[model samples]
Target: MSRIVILAEGSFQFHAAKTAVGVIRYSKDTVVAVIDSTKAGQDVAQALQTNFGIGIPIVRDIREALPYQPDTLLIGIAPRGGNLPAAWRWQLLTAIEAGMNIVSGLHFFLSDDEELRQAAEKHGVMLYDVRRPPEKKVVANYTPHRAGSHTILAVGSDCSTGKMTTMLELEQTARQRGLNSAFVATGQTGIMISGNGLPIDHIICDFLAGMVEEMVLDFCEKYDWVFVEGQGALNHPGYSPVTLGLLHGTLPDAMIFCHIAGATTIDGYQHCPLPSLPEMIRMNEDAVNWLHPHHNSKVVGISLLTHHLSEAEAHAEIQRIEQETGLPTVDVLRFGADPLVDAIQRYFNA
Candidate 1:
């Protein structure tokens, strides 16, 4: 396993640097340090206000993180378009010069970049682009794959709304209950954590659903319960296609709607307001029905992201959402995924 140093730089919040947070929380590799100038000289868990990376230190740059002897540098900045920021070039160069391999999940592949490529070649380091799609072509056949398997997909109100986190937590809780389960990663962060999954967003648009369907078929054949990770948002102007593709591809028997507790608009695109919980639920259900009329998939639960709320406030919000949606709901990371998992178990049992 690679000894890693995460480069979050200017973006190092729990919600902002999800790639950083996910790696810190779930990766098997050792994350020696995080490069965040703003939060330098602080504990990663303390800086992110989470209990994941307890002793991991936050430093100002690659040079500072070098003392930890990290052979790999992870670019954990998740921008709107996944573009490589101009300011981060020097940091990558510095890491490459120090003979550290670079790993990035951005759409902008560093290996394809001429300057970074030449520099990496000179230093004998590799550039691993996690989001690059496979060369093999695939297209959707829309074959229903849920004969003896249970497939669950997490749909979100907006991007970075905790779909991956919710599904991961749910999978962990399900395994403890002695159920045969698998977490099907769909994003780069999830792929990095699980070490095997196609980046749903990076796949070609025409082949998106087919690739997802292909993956789901493989997993359903092995695991009785397949929890496919979600991407983007169904109602989002920027990322709706990938969500739609994943929904159709996975053919989920049930979906858990994910949303940040007080969010009224799409993050980053604040001009686009979010729909009510009920309306969003209806939208996803209708979408599934439109694609596969015979499939009985519906939004079975709500995964509320209440990290922004206090404990008392979070409980109140969870209660309110449960009352509002008339479905089991909980903040997966904060309160555990028992409620949502129970709801799924109840649905399948009945």
Candidate 2:
């Protein structure tokens, strides 16, 4: 596994630094340090106000991290529009010049950029653009998945609502319980963790569903259970298409609705109010049923993200949501995924 130094720079909050957080929490690779000049001297745990990267030092720049002898620099934020920030260019080049591989999840392909690509070649380093979609094109095959296959998708109230985290925990818990489970990744962070999945958001719009279908089908061939990491939200102005593609292509037998507790509106779009939980549930289920009435898929559980809540508060919110939606609700990470797993099993076994 690579020794990673995450580059979050100016954006290092909980939501903005999701890539760095995800890689630290889930990746087997060692995260030696993090780069965020503003938070210099503080560890990632302190900066994020979470325990994810407990003792890892948060440094000021690429040069400061060189002493750690990190072989890789991971671009640790998926910025809006997925473009590489011009300010980060010199940091990446410096890393490359020092023979450190660059792993970026940006839509701007570092490998395709002449300067960076050439620098990488000259230095005998590599640039990994995880968001680059596969070259092949195939339309989604609208058909039933194989018999005995069970799939559950994570849908959410908005982006960064813990969809991938929920799905990942579900898969792990299911596997630990002796079930043959697979996690189908659909985003750059998920890909970084699972090492298998299309950057569905970067794939051509026409082939997005097809790409998802192929991944689900392949996993379903082997695993009895498939937990797909979802992207975006049904009501998101920018990301609804990716959400719909996953819904239609995977035809999940069950869905987990994810939401950050107490969130009133979409992050970065405060003017756009969020739908009521019940209404969002209705919209998601309706979208699926309207497309494939045969699937009879439903939101089987709620994965409420309560990282901001106290333990007591998190429990209270979970209970309140359960009473409101009448579905199994859990934090998954804070608590456990047993309730949601039970819901999926019950839904499928029924």
Per-residue lDDT tens digits for candidate 2, residues 1-350, read 99999999988887788888888989889999999999999998898777678999999999999999999999999777888889999999999999999999988899999999899999999899998889999798876787999888999999989999999999999999999999999999999988898888888889988878888888888989999998999999888988998888888888999999999998889899998999999999998888768878899999998888899999999999999999989999888999999999888778
* Candidate 2, superposed: residue stretches over 4 Å from native: none
Give the range where candidate 1 is weakest over 10 consecutive residues by summed lDDT: 288-297
lDDT of 2: 0.91
Per-residue lDDT for 162-228 in model 1, tens only? 8999989999999999999999999899988888899877788899989999999999988989998
Q: Compared to the true structure, candidate 2 yields what TM-score? A: 0.96
| lDDT (CA) per prediction | 0.90, 0.91
